[model samples]
Target: MGSNVDNALFFLVSTLFKLAIWVLILRVALQLVRADFFNPVSQLVWRLTQPVVGPLSGIVPRYRQWDLAGVLVLYVLAVLYIYAVFAILDYRVGLLPALWLGLLSLITMTLMLLTFSIFVQAILSWLGPGVNNRAGSVLWSLNEPLLSRIRRIVPMVSGIDLSPLVAILLLQVFYYLVPLHPVLR
Candidate 1:
Protein backbone atom coordinates (compact mmCIF):
# COMPACT_ATOMS: atom_id res chain seq x y z
CA MET A 1 0.00 0.00 0.00
CA GLY A 2 1.38 3.33 -1.06
CA SER A 3 1.35 6.40 1.16
CA ASN A 4 -1.41 8.06 -0.88
CA VAL A 5 -3.61 4.99 -0.70
CA ASP A 6 -3.04 4.73 3.04
CA ASN A 7 -3.94 8.39 3.49
CA ALA A 8 -7.15 7.96 1.50
CA LEU A 9 -8.11 4.84 3.42
CA PHE A 10 -7.46 6.58 6.71
CA PHE A 11 -9.58 9.53 5.67
CA LEU A 12 -12.49 7.36 4.55
CA VAL A 13 -12.46 5.23 7.68
CA SER A 14 -12.02 8.21 9.98
CA THR A 15 -14.97 10.05 8.47
CA LEU A 16 -17.35 7.11 8.71
CA PHE A 17 -16.31 6.16 12.22
CA LYS A 18 -16.44 9.75 13.43
CA LEU A 19 -19.89 10.21 11.97
CA ALA A 20 -21.16 7.20 13.91
CA ILE A 21 -19.39 8.33 17.05
CA TRP A 22 -21.00 11.80 16.80
CA VAL A 23 -24.45 10.27 16.41
CA LEU A 24 -23.86 8.10 19.47
CA ILE A 25 -22.80 11.15 21.45
CA LEU A 26 -25.94 12.95 20.33
CA ARG A 27 -28.04 9.94 21.33
CA VAL A 28 -26.62 9.94 24.83
CA ALA A 29 -26.86 13.73 25.17
CA LEU A 30 -30.42 13.70 23.89
CA GLN A 31 -31.39 11.30 26.62
CA LEU A 32 -29.45 13.24 29.24
CA VAL A 33 -31.25 16.47 28.37
CA ARG A 34 -34.55 14.63 28.06
CA ALA A 35 -34.99 16.05 24.57
CA ASP A 36 -38.25 15.56 22.76
CA PHE A 37 -38.19 11.95 21.63
CA PHE A 38 -40.99 12.61 19.18
CA ASN A 39 -39.04 15.26 17.33
CA PRO A 40 -38.07 14.30 13.80
CA VAL A 41 -34.41 14.85 14.55
CA SER A 42 -34.61 12.69 17.64
CA GLN A 43 -36.39 9.95 15.69
CA LEU A 44 -33.72 10.08 13.03
CA VAL A 45 -30.95 9.66 15.60
CA TRP A 46 -32.78 6.72 17.17
CA ARG A 47 -33.42 4.98 13.86
CA LEU A 48 -29.91 5.60 12.55
CA THR A 49 -28.39 4.12 15.71
CA GLN A 50 -30.95 1.38 16.49
CA PRO A 51 -29.29 -1.34 14.42
CA VAL A 52 -26.09 -0.94 16.43
CA VAL A 53 -27.40 0.25 19.79
CA GLY A 54 -30.50 -1.95 20.09
CA PRO A 55 -28.60 -5.15 20.80
CA LEU A 56 -26.16 -3.40 23.09
CA SER A 57 -29.03 -1.74 24.94
CA GLY A 58 -30.37 -5.17 25.77
CA ILE A 59 -27.01 -6.39 27.04
CA VAL A 60 -25.97 -3.21 28.88
CA PRO A 61 -28.26 -2.15 31.69
CA ARG A 62 -29.39 1.47 31.89
CA TYR A 63 -28.80 3.78 34.83
CA ARG A 64 -31.58 6.33 35.22
CA GLN A 65 -31.70 8.46 32.07
CA TRP A 66 -28.17 7.51 31.07
CA ASP A 67 -27.71 5.50 27.88
CA LEU A 68 -25.16 2.95 29.01
CA ALA A 69 -25.60 0.96 25.82
CA GLY A 70 -24.86 4.01 23.72
CA VAL A 71 -21.76 4.71 25.79
CA LEU A 72 -20.53 1.14 25.40
CA VAL A 73 -21.05 1.25 21.66
CA LEU A 74 -19.19 4.57 21.53
CA TYR A 75 -16.18 3.16 23.39
CA VAL A 76 -16.08 0.11 21.12
CA LEU A 77 -16.28 2.28 18.03
CA ALA A 78 -13.54 4.52 19.38
CA VAL A 79 -11.27 1.53 19.98
CA LEU A 80 -11.99 0.18 16.52
CA TYR A 81 -11.34 3.58 15.01
CA ILE A 82 -8.02 3.83 16.79
CA TYR A 83 -7.05 0.34 15.65
CA ALA A 84 -8.04 1.14 12.10
CA VAL A 85 -6.00 4.32 12.17
CA PHE A 86 -2.96 2.45 13.52
CA ALA A 87 -3.25 -0.19 10.84
CA ILE A 88 -3.68 2.38 8.14
CA LEU A 89 -0.68 4.35 9.39
CA ASP A 90 1.36 1.15 9.91
CA TYR A 91 2.01 1.91 13.56
CA ARG A 92 3.12 -1.17 15.51
CA VAL A 93 1.53 -0.28 18.84
CA GLY A 94 0.47 -2.73 21.53
CA LEU A 95 -3.17 -3.59 22.29
CA LEU A 96 -3.28 -1.96 25.72
CA PRO A 97 -1.81 1.25 24.37
CA ALA A 98 -4.35 1.28 21.59
CA LEU A 99 -7.11 0.81 24.14
CA TRP A 100 -5.82 3.69 26.23
CA LEU A 101 -5.40 5.88 23.17
CA GLY A 102 -8.94 5.04 22.15
CA LEU A 103 -10.25 6.30 25.46
CA LEU A 104 -8.29 9.53 25.13
CA SER A 105 -9.46 10.04 21.56
CA LEU A 106 -13.06 9.43 22.55
CA ILE A 107 -12.98 12.01 25.33
CA THR A 108 -11.23 14.52 23.08
CA MET A 109 -13.72 13.98 20.30
CA THR A 110 -16.67 14.31 22.66
CA LEU A 111 -15.42 17.64 23.98
CA MET A 112 -14.73 18.85 20.45
CA LEU A 113 -18.27 17.86 19.49
CA LEU A 114 -19.69 19.74 22.44
CA THR A 115 -17.80 22.85 21.40
CA PHE A 116 -19.15 22.42 17.88
CA SER A 117 -22.74 21.93 19.02
CA ILE A 118 -22.62 25.07 21.08
CA PHE A 119 -21.12 27.04 18.22
CA VAL A 120 -23.78 25.82 15.81
CA GLN A 121 -26.53 26.51 18.26
CA ALA A 122 -25.33 30.08 18.46
CA ILE A 123 -25.39 30.28 14.68
CA LEU A 124 -28.89 28.87 14.53
CA SER A 125 -30.06 31.40 17.04
CA TRP A 126 -28.51 34.17 15.02
CA LEU A 127 -30.01 32.95 11.78
CA GLY A 128 -33.47 32.39 13.15
CA PRO A 129 -34.38 33.27 16.64
CA GLY A 130 -37.54 31.52 17.88
CA VAL A 131 -37.63 29.30 14.80
CA ASN A 132 -39.71 26.17 15.29
CA ASN A 133 -37.63 23.47 13.61
CA ARG A 134 -36.89 19.98 14.85
CA ALA A 135 -33.17 20.21 14.18
CA GLY A 136 -32.86 23.54 15.92
CA SER A 137 -34.92 22.23 18.78
CA VAL A 138 -32.57 19.31 19.24
CA LEU A 139 -29.60 21.64 18.99
CA TRP A 140 -31.07 23.87 21.67
CA SER A 141 -31.82 20.89 23.85
CA LEU A 142 -28.25 19.72 23.48
CA ASN A 143 -26.91 23.16 24.34
CA GLU A 144 -29.28 24.24 27.11
CA PRO A 145 -27.76 22.08 29.82
CA LEU A 146 -24.40 23.72 29.41
CA LEU A 147 -25.71 27.18 28.60
CA SER A 148 -28.14 27.25 31.50
CA ARG A 149 -25.44 26.57 34.02
CA ILE A 150 -23.25 29.22 32.48
CA ARG A 151 -26.12 31.67 32.34
CA ARG A 152 -26.57 31.34 36.07
CA ILE A 153 -22.97 32.21 36.68
CA VAL A 154 -22.68 34.88 33.98
CA PRO A 155 -25.76 37.04 33.93
CA MET A 156 -27.16 38.40 30.73
CA VAL A 157 -26.27 42.03 30.12
CA SER A 158 -28.48 44.32 28.08
CA GLY A 159 -30.59 41.26 27.13
CA ILE A 160 -27.63 39.65 25.40
CA ASP A 161 -27.09 36.12 26.66
CA LEU A 162 -23.36 35.55 27.03
CA SER A 163 -23.62 32.01 28.26
CA PRO A 164 -22.94 30.33 24.93
CA LEU A 165 -19.78 32.37 24.39
CA VAL A 166 -18.58 31.67 27.90
CA ALA A 167 -19.46 27.99 27.61
CA ILE A 168 -17.50 27.60 24.38
CA LEU A 169 -14.46 29.30 25.87
CA LEU A 170 -14.57 27.05 28.92
CA LEU A 171 -14.98 23.89 26.86
CA GLN A 172 -12.17 24.98 24.54
CA VAL A 173 -9.88 25.55 27.47
CA PHE A 174 -10.64 22.20 29.08
CA TYR A 175 -10.22 20.14 25.93
CA TYR A 176 -7.10 21.91 24.68
CA LEU A 177 -5.47 22.06 28.12
CA VAL A 178 -5.80 18.31 28.66
CA PRO A 179 -2.51 16.69 27.62
CA LEU A 180 -3.17 14.29 24.76
CA HIS A 181 0.11 12.39 25.03
CA PRO A 182 -0.83 9.73 27.58
CA VAL A 183 1.62 7.46 29.42
CA LEU A 184 1.35 4.94 26.59
CA ARG A 185 3.20 7.22 24.24
Candidate 2:
Protein backbone atom coordinates (compact mmCIF):
# COMPACT_ATOMS: atom_id res chain seq x y z
CA MET A 1 0.00 0.00 0.00
CA GLY A 2 1.06 3.56 -0.57
CA SER A 3 2.37 5.35 2.51
CA ASN A 4 -0.58 7.76 2.59
CA VAL A 5 -3.12 4.96 2.18
CA ASP A 6 -1.39 2.86 4.80
CA ASN A 7 -1.36 5.75 7.23
CA ALA A 8 -5.05 6.47 6.63
CA LEU A 9 -6.04 2.88 7.17
CA PHE A 10 -3.93 2.68 10.28
CA PHE A 11 -5.58 5.81 11.67
CA LEU A 12 -9.07 4.44 11.06
CA VAL A 13 -8.31 1.07 12.61
CA SER A 14 -6.45 2.54 15.56
CA THR A 15 -9.28 4.95 16.29
CA LEU A 16 -11.91 2.21 16.38
CA PHE A 17 -9.66 -0.02 18.46
CA LYS A 18 -8.94 2.80 20.86
CA LEU A 19 -12.64 3.52 21.26
CA ALA A 20 -13.21 -0.10 22.28
CA ILE A 21 -10.30 0.07 24.68
CA TRP A 22 -11.75 3.21 26.26
CA VAL A 23 -15.05 1.44 26.88
CA LEU A 24 -13.18 -1.37 28.61
CA ILE A 25 -11.22 1.17 30.60
CA LEU A 26 -14.49 2.76 31.68
CA ARG A 27 -15.80 -0.57 32.87
CA VAL A 28 -12.70 -1.26 34.93
CA ALA A 29 -12.54 2.22 36.39
CA LEU A 30 -16.26 2.26 37.18
CA GLN A 31 -15.97 -1.03 39.02
CA LEU A 32 -12.90 0.13 40.89
CA VAL A 33 -14.63 3.35 41.87
CA ARG A 34 -17.79 1.46 42.89
CA ALA A 35 -19.96 3.46 40.54
CA ASP A 36 -23.60 2.47 40.24
CA PHE A 37 -23.46 -0.58 38.02
CA PHE A 38 -27.08 -0.17 37.02
CA ASN A 39 -26.51 3.25 35.56
CA PRO A 40 -27.35 3.38 31.86
CA VAL A 41 -23.84 4.35 30.85
CA SER A 42 -22.36 1.67 33.09
CA GLN A 43 -24.67 -0.94 31.62
CA LEU A 44 -23.80 0.19 28.13
CA VAL A 45 -20.10 -0.20 28.78
CA TRP A 46 -20.66 -3.63 30.26
CA ARG A 47 -22.88 -4.82 27.43
CA LEU A 48 -20.51 -3.53 24.78
CA THR A 49 -17.47 -5.28 26.26
CA GLN A 50 -19.23 -8.39 27.59
CA PRO A 51 -18.50 -10.58 24.57
CA VAL A 52 -14.73 -10.16 24.76
CA VAL A 53 -14.41 -9.88 28.51
CA GLY A 54 -16.79 -12.76 29.15
CA PRO A 55 -14.50 -15.30 27.52
CA LEU A 56 -11.34 -13.87 29.05
CA SER A 57 -12.89 -13.65 32.50
CA GLY A 58 -12.83 -17.43 32.67
CA ILE A 59 -9.04 -17.52 32.32
CA VAL A 60 -7.76 -14.17 33.55
CA PRO A 61 -10.01 -14.03 36.61
CA ARG A 62 -11.24 -10.93 38.37
CA TYR A 63 -9.41 -9.86 41.52
CA ARG A 64 -11.99 -8.34 43.85
CA GLN A 65 -13.33 -5.23 42.12
CA TRP A 66 -10.59 -5.03 39.53
CA ASP A 67 -11.53 -6.44 36.14
CA LEU A 68 -8.37 -8.27 35.20
CA ALA A 69 -10.06 -9.74 32.15
CA GLY A 70 -10.75 -6.33 30.73
CA VAL A 71 -7.23 -5.29 31.66
CA LEU A 72 -5.64 -8.25 29.90
CA VAL A 73 -7.68 -7.49 26.81
CA LEU A 74 -6.47 -3.88 26.98
CA TYR A 75 -2.85 -4.98 27.23
CA VAL A 76 -3.11 -7.29 24.23
CA LEU A 77 -4.77 -4.59 22.15
CA ALA A 78 -2.21 -1.99 23.16
CA VAL A 79 0.72 -4.27 22.38
CA LEU A 80 -0.72 -5.05 18.96
CA TYR A 81 -1.34 -1.36 18.24
CA ILE A 82 2.18 -0.48 19.30
CA TYR A 83 3.60 -3.16 17.07
CA ALA A 84 1.57 -1.83 14.17
CA VAL A 85 2.93 1.64 14.77
CA PHE A 86 6.47 0.33 14.76
CA ALA A 87 5.84 -1.55 11.54
CA ILE A 88 4.38 1.53 9.86
CA LEU A 89 7.42 3.53 10.87
CA ASP A 90 9.79 0.85 9.52
CA TYR A 91 11.26 0.42 12.99
CA ARG A 92 11.50 -2.40 15.49
CA VAL A 93 10.77 -2.50 19.22
CA GLY A 94 11.29 -5.26 21.73
CA LEU A 95 8.26 -6.90 23.30
CA LEU A 96 9.22 -5.63 26.74
CA PRO A 97 9.55 -2.03 25.55
CA ALA A 98 6.31 -2.24 23.68
CA LEU A 99 4.54 -3.79 26.66
CA TRP A 100 5.81 -1.14 29.04
CA LEU A 101 4.81 1.67 26.71
CA GLY A 102 1.47 0.06 26.05
CA LEU A 103 0.63 0.08 29.74
CA LEU A 104 1.71 3.69 29.96
CA SER A 105 -0.53 4.50 27.03
CA LEU A 106 -3.49 3.06 28.94
CA ILE A 107 -2.76 5.26 31.92
CA THR A 108 -2.31 8.22 29.63
CA MET A 109 -5.67 7.61 28.04
CA THR A 110 -7.37 7.23 31.42
CA LEU A 111 -5.90 10.47 32.65
CA MET A 112 -7.13 12.16 29.49
CA LEU A 113 -10.64 10.81 30.06
CA LEU A 114 -10.72 12.03 33.63
CA THR A 115 -9.41 15.44 32.68
CA PHE A 116 -11.97 15.74 29.92
CA SER A 117 -14.85 14.54 32.07
CA ILE A 118 -13.98 17.10 34.69
CA PHE A 119 -14.21 19.86 32.10
CA VAL A 120 -17.55 18.64 30.81
CA GLN A 121 -18.97 18.25 34.30
CA ALA A 122 -17.89 21.75 35.13
CA ILE A 123 -19.57 23.07 32.03
CA LEU A 124 -22.77 21.24 32.87
CA SER A 125 -22.76 22.63 36.38
CA TRP A 126 -22.27 26.14 35.06
CA LEU A 127 -25.27 25.72 32.86
CA GLY A 128 -27.42 25.16 35.95
CA PRO A 129 -27.36 23.94 39.50
CA GLY A 130 -29.01 20.68 38.49
CA VAL A 131 -28.32 19.57 34.95
CA ASN A 132 -29.16 15.91 35.28
CA ASN A 133 -28.43 13.58 32.39
CA ARG A 134 -27.03 10.13 31.82
CA ALA A 135 -23.69 11.42 30.64
CA GLY A 136 -23.45 13.94 33.47
CA SER A 137 -24.32 11.29 36.00
CA VAL A 138 -21.64 8.96 34.73
CA LEU A 139 -19.08 11.72 34.69
CA TRP A 140 -20.03 12.73 38.20
CA SER A 141 -19.83 9.17 39.43
CA LEU A 142 -16.35 8.75 38.02
CA ASN A 143 -14.99 12.15 39.07
CA GLU A 144 -16.75 12.91 42.36
CA PRO A 145 -14.47 10.54 44.25
CA LEU A 146 -11.37 12.53 43.31
CA LEU A 147 -13.00 15.95 43.23
CA SER A 148 -14.51 15.53 46.68
CA ARG A 149 -11.08 14.91 48.14
CA ILE A 150 -9.74 18.06 46.53
CA ARG A 151 -12.75 20.00 47.77
CA ARG A 152 -11.79 19.13 51.34
CA ILE A 153 -8.46 20.92 51.17
CA VAL A 154 -9.40 23.64 48.71
CA PRO A 155 -12.30 25.76 49.83
CA MET A 156 -14.52 27.57 47.38
CA VAL A 157 -13.54 31.21 46.81
CA SER A 158 -16.54 33.47 47.26
CA GLY A 159 -19.21 31.75 45.17
CA ILE A 160 -16.93 29.91 42.83
CA ASP A 161 -15.98 26.29 43.36
CA LEU A 162 -12.37 25.72 42.38
CA SER A 163 -12.41 22.01 43.06
CA PRO A 164 -12.54 21.08 39.43
CA LEU A 165 -9.62 23.32 38.55
CA VAL A 166 -7.61 22.07 41.49
CA ALA A 167 -8.40 18.49 40.62
CA ILE A 168 -7.42 18.96 36.98
CA LEU A 169 -4.19 20.68 37.97
CA LEU A 170 -3.23 17.77 40.21
CA LEU A 171 -4.25 15.23 37.58
CA GLN A 172 -2.35 17.08 34.87
CA VAL A 173 0.75 17.24 37.06
CA PHE A 174 0.55 13.52 37.74
CA TYR A 175 -0.19 12.83 34.09
CA TYR A 176 2.96 14.67 32.97
CA LEU A 177 5.11 13.36 35.82
CA VAL A 178 4.33 9.74 35.06
CA PRO A 179 5.63 9.90 31.46
CA LEU A 180 2.20 8.55 30.57
CA HIS A 181 2.29 9.30 26.84
CA PRO A 182 5.62 7.68 25.96
CA VAL A 183 4.07 5.39 23.37
CA LEU A 184 2.28 8.34 21.82
CA ARG A 185 5.58 9.89 20.71
Candidate 3:
Protein backbone atom coordinates (compact mmCIF):
# COMPACT_ATOMS: atom_id res chain seq x y z
CA MET A 1 0.00 0.00 0.00
CA GLY A 2 2.79 2.39 0.92
CA SER A 3 4.68 1.64 -2.28
CA ASN A 4 1.52 2.24 -4.32
CA VAL A 5 0.99 5.57 -2.59
CA ASP A 6 4.55 6.60 -3.31
CA ASN A 7 4.15 5.66 -6.96
CA ALA A 8 0.96 7.65 -7.20
CA LEU A 9 2.61 10.69 -5.70
CA PHE A 10 5.52 10.45 -8.07
CA PHE A 11 3.21 10.16 -11.03
CA LEU A 12 1.20 13.13 -9.94
CA VAL A 13 4.26 15.27 -9.47
CA SER A 14 5.77 14.31 -12.80
CA THR A 15 2.51 14.92 -14.61
CA LEU A 16 2.14 18.34 -13.09
CA PHE A 17 5.69 19.24 -14.02
CA LYS A 18 5.15 18.18 -17.60
CA LEU A 19 1.90 20.12 -17.78
CA ALA A 20 3.64 23.27 -16.58
CA ILE A 21 6.37 22.93 -19.17
CA TRP A 22 3.82 22.38 -21.96
CA VAL A 23 1.95 25.48 -20.92
CA LEU A 24 5.14 27.49 -20.87
CA ILE A 25 6.05 26.23 -24.32
CA LEU A 26 2.63 27.08 -25.74
CA ARG A 27 2.78 30.57 -24.25
CA VAL A 28 6.16 31.20 -25.81
CA ALA A 29 5.10 29.87 -29.19
CA LEU A 30 1.95 31.98 -29.21
CA GLN A 31 3.97 35.06 -28.38
CA LEU A 32 6.57 34.27 -31.01
CA VAL A 33 3.84 33.95 -33.62
CA ARG A 34 2.36 37.23 -32.40
CA ALA A 35 -1.08 35.96 -31.49
CA ASP A 36 -3.66 38.48 -30.33
CA PHE A 37 -1.91 39.42 -27.14
CA PHE A 38 -4.56 41.87 -26.09
CA ASN A 39 -7.44 39.44 -26.04
CA PRO A 40 -8.79 37.95 -22.81
CA VAL A 41 -7.53 34.48 -23.66
CA SER A 42 -4.10 35.81 -24.39
CA GLN A 43 -4.17 37.78 -21.17
CA LEU A 44 -4.86 34.59 -19.28
CA VAL A 45 -2.02 32.79 -21.02
CA TRP A 46 0.29 35.68 -20.26
CA ARG A 47 -0.70 35.68 -16.62
CA LEU A 48 -0.02 31.99 -16.34
CA THR A 49 3.29 32.36 -18.18
CA GLN A 50 4.58 35.50 -16.52
CA PRO A 51 5.71 33.67 -13.41
CA VAL A 52 8.51 32.05 -15.40
CA VAL A 53 8.99 34.54 -18.23
CA GLY A 54 9.06 37.70 -16.17
CA PRO A 55 12.32 36.84 -14.45
CA LEU A 56 14.11 35.78 -17.61
CA SER A 57 13.08 38.93 -19.41
CA GLY A 58 15.98 40.69 -17.72
CA ILE A 59 18.59 38.38 -19.27
CA VAL A 60 17.19 37.99 -22.80
CA PRO A 61 16.40 40.97 -24.97
CA ARG A 62 13.10 41.46 -26.73
CA TYR A 63 13.23 41.58 -30.55
CA ARG A 64 10.95 43.30 -33.02
CA GLN A 65 7.73 43.27 -31.02
CA TRP A 66 8.32 39.60 -30.29
CA ASP A 67 8.92 38.22 -26.84
CA LEU A 68 12.05 36.26 -27.58
CA ALA A 69 13.09 36.57 -23.96
CA GLY A 70 9.94 34.69 -22.99
CA VAL A 71 10.71 31.96 -25.49
CA LEU A 72 14.24 31.55 -24.14
CA VAL A 73 12.83 31.32 -20.66
CA LEU A 74 10.49 28.54 -21.76
CA TYR A 75 13.38 26.65 -23.38
CA VAL A 76 15.58 26.94 -20.29
CA LEU A 77 12.75 25.86 -18.03
CA ALA A 78 11.93 22.87 -20.23
CA VAL A 79 15.56 21.69 -20.18
CA LEU A 80 15.85 22.06 -16.42
CA TYR A 81 12.54 20.35 -15.83
CA ILE A 82 13.47 17.41 -18.03
CA TYR A 83 16.78 17.10 -16.23
CA ALA A 84 15.03 17.08 -12.91
CA VAL A 85 12.57 14.44 -14.06
CA PHE A 86 15.36 12.24 -15.32
CA ALA A 87 17.22 12.63 -12.07
CA ILE A 88 14.13 11.64 -10.12
CA LEU A 89 13.79 8.52 -12.25
CA ASP A 90 17.47 7.69 -11.65
CA TYR A 91 18.28 7.89 -15.34
CA ARG A 92 21.88 8.56 -16.30
CA VAL A 93 22.12 11.36 -18.86
CA GLY A 94 24.03 14.56 -19.48
CA LEU A 95 22.30 17.91 -19.22
CA LEU A 96 23.48 19.13 -22.62
CA PRO A 97 21.97 16.17 -24.46
CA ALA A 98 18.62 16.64 -22.79
CA LEU A 99 18.74 20.38 -23.46
CA TRP A 100 19.40 19.82 -27.14
CA LEU A 101 16.56 17.35 -27.43
CA GLY A 102 14.18 19.71 -25.70
CA LEU A 103 15.17 22.61 -27.88
CA LEU A 104 14.95 20.60 -31.09
CA SER A 105 11.55 19.25 -30.17
CA LEU A 106 10.39 22.78 -29.51
CA ILE A 107 11.71 24.02 -32.83
CA THR A 108 10.25 21.14 -34.78
CA MET A 109 6.85 21.62 -33.22
CA THR A 110 6.97 25.35 -33.93
CA LEU A 111 7.76 24.78 -37.56
CA MET A 112 4.99 22.25 -37.91
CA LEU A 113 2.52 24.71 -36.45
CA LEU A 114 3.72 27.39 -38.82
CA THR A 115 3.38 25.08 -41.78
CA PHE A 116 -0.14 24.13 -40.80
CA SER A 117 -1.01 27.77 -40.45
CA ILE A 118 0.19 28.50 -43.96
CA PHE A 119 -1.79 25.64 -45.39
CA VAL A 120 -4.89 26.86 -43.64
CA GLN A 121 -4.41 30.35 -45.01
CA ALA A 122 -3.95 29.04 -48.53
CA ILE A 123 -7.24 27.18 -48.23
CA LEU A 124 -9.01 30.24 -46.90
CA SER A 125 -7.70 32.33 -49.76
CA TRP A 126 -9.28 29.89 -52.14
CA LEU A 127 -12.68 30.57 -50.57
CA GLY A 128 -12.51 34.32 -51.21
CA PRO A 129 -10.72 37.51 -50.25
CA GLY A 130 -11.52 39.38 -47.01
CA VAL A 131 -12.14 36.18 -45.11
CA ASN A 132 -11.26 38.12 -41.95
CA ASN A 133 -10.13 34.97 -40.26
CA ARG A 134 -7.85 35.59 -37.33
CA ALA A 135 -5.94 32.35 -37.86
CA GLY A 136 -5.35 33.28 -41.49
CA SER A 137 -3.93 36.61 -40.46
CA VAL A 138 -1.60 35.02 -37.94
CA LEU A 139 -0.41 32.52 -40.52
CA TRP A 140 0.20 35.24 -43.10
CA SER A 141 2.20 37.30 -40.62
CA LEU A 142 4.37 34.38 -39.51
CA ASN A 143 4.96 33.10 -43.01
CA GLU A 144 5.56 36.42 -44.81
CA PRO A 145 9.26 36.57 -43.99
CA LEU A 146 9.91 33.01 -45.12
CA LEU A 147 7.70 33.31 -48.19
CA SER A 148 9.36 36.61 -49.10
CA ARG A 149 12.78 34.97 -49.14
CA ILE A 150 11.50 32.09 -51.23
CA ARG A 151 9.88 34.55 -53.61
CA ARG A 152 13.22 36.27 -54.15
CA ILE A 153 14.84 32.94 -54.96
CA VAL A 154 12.06 31.39 -57.04
CA PRO A 155 9.86 33.67 -59.03
CA MET A 156 6.18 32.77 -58.94
CA VAL A 157 5.42 30.38 -61.79
CA SER A 158 2.13 31.16 -63.61
CA GLY A 159 1.03 33.36 -60.66
CA ILE A 160 0.90 30.37 -58.35
CA ASP A 161 2.45 30.72 -54.88
CA LEU A 162 5.13 28.11 -54.21
CA SER A 163 6.52 29.43 -50.98
CA PRO A 164 4.26 27.34 -48.79
CA LEU A 165 5.39 24.19 -50.53
CA VAL A 166 9.02 25.06 -49.99
CA ALA A 167 8.41 25.95 -46.38
CA ILE A 168 6.62 22.66 -45.74
CA LEU A 169 9.47 20.73 -47.33
CA LEU A 170 12.06 22.46 -45.19
CA LEU A 171 10.01 21.75 -42.09
CA GLN A 172 9.79 18.10 -43.06
CA VAL A 173 13.56 17.89 -43.40
CA PHE A 174 14.08 19.30 -39.96
CA TYR A 175 11.47 16.98 -38.52
CA TYR A 176 13.03 13.85 -39.98
CA LEU A 177 16.74 14.36 -40.59
CA VAL A 178 18.00 16.46 -37.70
CA PRO A 179 19.23 14.52 -34.71
CA LEU A 180 17.96 15.86 -31.44
CA HIS A 181 21.57 16.06 -30.40
CA PRO A 182 24.90 14.63 -31.56
CA VAL A 183 25.64 12.94 -28.25
CA LEU A 184 22.12 11.64 -27.83
CA ARG A 185 22.53 9.67 -31.04
Q: Choose the strongest candidate by lDDT.
A: 1
Rank candidates by TM-score, best first.
1, 2, 3
Residue-pair clashes per prediction, in order, are 0, 0, 0
The global Cα lDDT (0 to 1) of model 3 is 0.68
Please state the error at residue 117 of candidate 3 in Å. 2.2
Question: What TM-score would every model get versus the actual structure?
Answer: 0.91, 0.89, 0.64
Top candidate on TM-score is: 1
lDDT of 3 by residue, 35-99 (tens): 77775555676899897788878888888766777777767765765576556666766867787
Q: Mind giving the per-residue lDDT tens digits that candidate 2 earns over 37-115?
A: 8889899999999998899888987899899998888788878877877787677899898999788877777887889
For residue 151, give model 2's deviation from the true position in Å.
0.7
User: lDDT by residue for model 1 over 1-185, one digit each (tens)?
Assistant: 46887778777888898889889988988999999999999999999999999998888999999999998998889889888877876777788987887888777788889999889888888898988777888988988888898988999999888998999899888887766654211
User: Could you give the C-alpha RMSD of every candidate to the true structure, in order shown?
Assistant: 2.6, 2.2, 5.6
Taken over the whole model, the C-alpha lDDT of each candidate is 0.85, 0.83, 0.68
Worst 10 residues of 3 by lDDT: 176-185
Number of the candidate with higher lDDT, 1 or 2:
1
